[model samples]
Target: MSKPRRWLVAIAGAVVAAGLAVPPSAVAQADEPIQDPLPDPVPSSLGLTVAEFAQFPKTELTPPPPDPPPDLRLIRHARINHLGEVPDGSGRLYVPDLNGRVYLVENGTQHIYVDFKAQFPDFFSGRGLGSGSGFVTFHPDFKRNGKFYTVHTENGAGLTKPTTWPSHSANPFLHSIITEWTATDPSADTFSGTRRQVMRIAEARQVHAIQQIDFNPYARKGSRDYGVLYVASGDGGQGATTTEPQQLGNPYGKILRINPTGTNGTGGQFGIPSDNPFVGTPGALGEIYAIGMRDPHRFSWDRATGRMYLGHIGEHRIEAVYDVRAGDNYGWSEREGEFLYKRNDPQCSVYPLPPDDAQYGYDYPVAAFDHNPPPGHPLCSDSGHAISGGFVYRGSIAELRGKYVFTDLVDGRIFYTEASEMRRGRPAAQIHQFQVYANGQRTDFRQLVGDARVDLRFGQDARGELYLVAKANGKVYKVTGIKRFASCAVGHTRVTGSGGADSWSPVTPDKWQFRGDSVILAEAGEARPGPRRPFEYAVLDKGPAFTNARVDTKVRLDTPVEVTNRDVIVVFGYASDTEFYYAHVSTDNTIYPHNGIFAVNNADRLRIDDQWNEVMSRGAPPAITDTAWHDVSVTHCADTGEISVRVDGELLMTAVDHTFGAGRTGFGSFDNIGRARDFRATGTAA
Candidate 1:
């Protein structure tokens, strides 16, 4: 027989064993008639007397209030498509966009100080210089040297020669390039001066080319003195791939720290810093501080902690933020987020490095989100294809103080984190406390819109104010604070039976049914995730009533599960109803069930006696005994359509049934009469 049918049989047997009447055997076994006498009925309630019910509380304790909301403002908006900030508090902004024109927004009045394409007319060639993929940064002593640098994609030099190759061989186009320039006057805004060629790498693909560049903020100016320039290169322009050897050594998929002067030390463009992590590492490039990055769109440093935060685009499932330390290797091409992606078990060779490998530093993201919106909460999802890292809020906004603010380019939702709550460890710890701010209320940070993209790169001024770069409209928005709203209270009450003070309603009474009573199911408990032992919920089910109608009690779980899928069931129904609902063969619950079942459903709504049809079931034999108290409701949803049943919130038999949805709705037929059925079908027996 199928599991569902077997479950029905078992439940029938239990009812008979509990001294309940059973119809004549519908199906006979081939062997001898093995029927046993009925057992004592188990009451739904564990036998609490009248005095005990009087002392029980009726309502749940309220949750603590959340932190107040802050006042929000929109300071200034810029028309730049993409933007980056200078590390030194110099109130200047660098913007580049689809126009292929790179402009410098300098000083206080949002002035376009330098135009790169205008200064280098021949180099630009009118093709608009492709996309302004990189930001401009000055040498440490810009006041004295007047030297600054930028990385961008320029029209490729055409080649006429043709060569033969296998048909399956790959042939890619080149569109990305990096270059450095110096201003003629140290104090002037124009870039009318000498153009020095630092180093240019070939872009075999157009997608992930020339992301962003920055000069080490800590680097100083002097011959052999200034720190190395840090260039964040995407892994080719394409998505995740390991076929290119250039990604490892050719400065393509890395954060390359190079000295503008050449390696020979004299007359070179840039000098490499002496403290470069890979200066002497075997078979590794000397300029590499860390390696193994894919589509590293943006990165930032916390001035207070010197911690580097990287926003990496994942191939699937997750968009992660990493806390990078020197020599750390962020797993890419082999792993995404904290899960392993690639492996060769025979010899156990992995591309980015194995999870257990200690030589390479595997940094963990400080915060992460799924690409798609989670079930129940749809507002947190962003439409952007990639995740962008923003600056740590060192700004003057009192509400944003000491928080890390970021946004998803696709959905344009703003999220922030409390600095103190972030985990601090070796590579970097994921931020579990990140929250989304909508209007003035804090809502679940999930997919808000199915289709909205915002290209959010960070923008900061000398004063530390933060700004966002919007890609769709090519604009920048300065983040201001928003005010918080008063907290609202939520409560629930259940009524059973009638005609005393008009306060009580009628409910189906089972074997040990009581006349009039109510119960409190939940009180104080830990809100945090992880194994919470001895968590308690209160039960109250005794009082005077005014009317007569069957009332049902229900409990719902709001928190998502992480570790063990177990919950403590606290119930206070009439003793008989509780016993029937807690029948060994009739309970089932699970997590992530196949049918998209959730806790919130129509049945969860409290009902008056007349409305009890929404959950009542007729025709099935009653499972409750008149004078017994029992505990029920231990259930779980399996990864599949199966439901594991337990009594009194404890494990029972796991029965597989395709008819039931993942969600449990109604709660009327207190006894086993409607046990193991899907939504209770209604009809009173004649």
Candidate 2:
């Protein structure tokens, strides 16, 4: 299979199927039809839900050396790539940082297992996207053999060092090397071992050298793939104009299968698996398993179904996930996510597929998303999106079961599709966005990271539980649970009781003014003699007692905006004047009693909301900074004792407790003048 014949076969197959009798000269003169490469926008409304993630107690690692170029896309304090439970079953997890250290973590403590950067002075990193310790994986029998492997990149060594493949780039910029290590004691926390080079290959450029390496976790001890290693190699950033992926002579743009313990490979470094796809093909590398990829960033095996999936980052148009199989050709430099990709076309790099595209024998994505940039940004640039590979959730979260969860590398938006719907030949599965929450308040990864680009990654443990790595912040989070709220049976209702107790009941009736359907806190509540508490608040006696309640109302601070102490409140779980919960929506949050969800139980109100800074005894920014009317909502769930407050539809704070249940709802002010109207309550009636 020569390179020229491969191109001719792909082109000729499409032309002959069209039944055209045109000569070669005429075909050359006619312009080739083009197609739009951008994928359809993801489904907006279907399958939308929130996933609750909790941070580990104390697992922050030391920052890596500063990136020389400081490119935000690749910059991070610690470029932590992945996390996996050690094969020895110590119930401990090992995390690999691209800057060259593998840390064994247990009970929020980190111990250095290996220091590749300190050992190998020639190691190169912090200069480019993937120019560091790439990945590490343990052999299935690691407990017995004490064997493991790793991948890393080098700069000057690539030009001078001998490589396993002779057909490498003449002017190589970097080289990716794989090394196998033998540990003296498998159960030890630190590594005391000797390593040997398994394989090395020159890279054309710096960006996409080699990303990940691993073994299929589901493989049995007697299976052929039990200890076999799979290395995902990229095109080294040269596939756009050159057919680097299509060529079969080199390991670039392909997945390679080899045996680390055997010595029958090139230069006697490792063994090329006899079952590899190109073992007998003339002029083809025996190690090639699958070819035709730009940057196969990550790959994983589904434990339940024994299926392999790969996440590939495209040049401009698509970010894809493939149902990978042995010998499959994922067309790159020719097709991008089922659409034609025009090489070196600066203005329009993607086009529609030809009618006879099937004859080319190119496989396509099973779940994919398009690059969506802001209004003025470039259409075909790296600013938009990249696909970060993820695992199927067979974890403890029942709602996330059977979904192939993944994320966008740039904006940190998590997404997923039905793993059962992902098949090789069908149209791509529909992608849906997953809502995220931390500390019980709704949030996105961008907000959680507090950065424009999240630089996010995913990892899974032996128990099938998932973790999220923020490369920008150097933190790991466990997917603790899922948040699913049941709807209230009472639905929605409004208050209008002609100034009677049926609509509103003020604790201190003399301090409040009531009209037809409105109540005003005419005077400020006096300071208590002992424990501070809201001396005046109105309870909605007309509504049924609710176990799970949602309160909606419009509030206006009667004082001037310059009065920084002014506030309005929404009360729920109102068993009595001394036992209730109130959302203190105030103009100033610098004090302990303002702008938070507080609970009173015969004592000073205690702050229980997630957003409160416990050290400072303060909360987030002011919820009511002006005198204008603002919509407020207070939600309470007696079953979980979860309460959250929203101002103008944005989440302000959240709290959880079991102090009270099946109570009334109301509105007022803590110690300032305010007015409330259009009050409503919806929930499961007691």
Candidate 3:
């Protein structure tokens, strides 16, 4: 057989070249060790700072309507699946609930735009998590065409009808149907028009069916892709038992591209684009654009590069995001992520790839994360299984620009990677997890939604701003603003009290004494009247006020090690003795205020670091445990509001806060004694 030209060097590319052909079955032998069991849970690097803002409240509809069958009931408070804006330039957005209602949102107010259950009595959204009113999208010319589309599932309603796509399962259970809706008034708030069936596919089960359908938002009116709709179809959880995904005749496990207005497809429902990848191939469906997928759940295109990205839910160990290209086959049953999926040997679901494995020509993901659940949890539990695809941020937020932000569907942990690094042939890009915020304080989706399983999804607007849609409380949060820090590579100078070019002044001169080059905290000062904060410290009175400050010094704890809370604090963003942020590197981390990064703003210090766990009694280890001097550095970026504290050249703790900016640096303690020397500071002089 001829080698597939679309194949490129990828995972295990160093093992062998693409020209060395070998039998596909030779890729995984029974005796091979399970070299790649699971991926590391923690990402090694850090990326852009991300924050989510609460945008809209819960929708009007509470699904199941207080009385429904057990199979129809939902565990979440609402089933808000996806959100998107209408292409008519109305600045209006639409959100679809799995309970069959699509609400039109204007600013913060929402009204029922259409109800699938009320319009089509046979519309089914029960018995499976994915079986519901799935998705909706508008034509690019929606301002003049008055046309749009939707995909939904039914409980075997179309079994008698001829399925447009072929399936190997004889006991097909659910039917995924697509329809075209024409609005009477293109500019109306509510949909009022005629409807027509586009196509239907019979599936073995309810899950892993059609979940997303959208038109290329970047396609111009005269472009060939202008009216084309891309349908993401899954294998209905049957890819492992059958080899149908490798066959060209099946639409399942494929992304089908078709012209909704043309009439050349099966059943005369839609037109298969002539330029489709498999149009003229023998026994292949003309509508297939790309094949070999288990669950092509969600996909989006980057506006800057016009490259498509799809999040494919894996079978057992991997969850991945693919850099999709036409005519490229993504290996599903045969491989997961970059490893071989052993079918006959269920004991080892994945194994290392053989030497000549690339000859089969399977495309791999550009970025992926593996399953890591609690001990004894089910292999593919919902704890962390699915990947919710997201777009490359061309949004108004400057910090998030050019980053492809996505999340885990179950855990709701947000992640992003540089769009430039998501190349197909080379190694996968490094993915970074970002913290979530609500109202102005640092928070997480679990805390905001009050559910361990966040059931998270994403939405993007015409202006490129993004939103976080949580099914837990039916609330939508917008990306109001982002904070990024500037580098401390400029205006660096040494600081000393010898009254030279750069010097310092003690806040409480009586409580501090200079011994050669070391500044000693001789005694603790009286408690402040307003808030409980650092009582004694010396300020950078000679240097210019700095933003994005970096301070490096050597500190020795003068207090005995037996003092549980003995600490040497580094302070920056200091507008006054009362307003400043500090990294309290203490001897004990069990206490809430000890060994944490904090911000004091005319009030008591608030713990801002992510490492502080009040219930778990855990935090960064003591930076200064004895009388020995320890090398410490504190870097704060005012642009991103990121503060990082390092001990002995290793990052110990970090926090994000914009409460104060462009302030002087200082060193002392919260209520203990310490001494500092070799003090140096660098930052943007404000």
Q: Model 1, which residues run further than 4 Å from truth?
A: 1-90, 104-111, 116-133, 158-172, 186-190, 218-227, 237-248, 261-267, 343-361, 373-384, 417-451, 485-686
Q: Write the residue-wise lDDT of candidate 3 on 387-491 in tens digits.
A: 888889998777788988888978788888888988776667767676664555556788878888888988998888888888887787777766332233545
Local accuracy of candidate 1 as per-residue lDDT tens digits, 296-381 = 77776676666667777765445667766555555564445544434222211112223233322334455665443233322223
- lDDT top scorer: 3
In model 2, state the lDDT of residue 262: 82
In candidate 3, how many Å is residue 172 off? Answer: 1.7
lDDT of each: 0.39, 0.74, 0.75
Model 1 lDDT vs. the true structure? 0.39
- Report how far off residue 542 is in candidate 1 (Å): 17
Q: Point out where model 3 deviates above 4 Å.
A: 1-73, 156-158, 344-349, 485-632, 635-643, 646-686
User: All candidates' TM-scores?
Assistant: 0.54, 0.67, 0.72
In candidate 3, the residue pairs with backbone N, CA or C atoms under 3 Å apart (3 or more residues apart, or in different chains) clash, namely: 483-640, 484-639, 484-640, 485-640
Give the lowest summed-lDDT range of ten residues in model 1: 47-56
Candidate number that wins on lDDT, 1 or 3: 3
> lDDT tens string, model 2, 624-655?
88888899988887876767687887666767
For candidate 3, which ten residues in a row score worst on lDDT?
A: 8-17
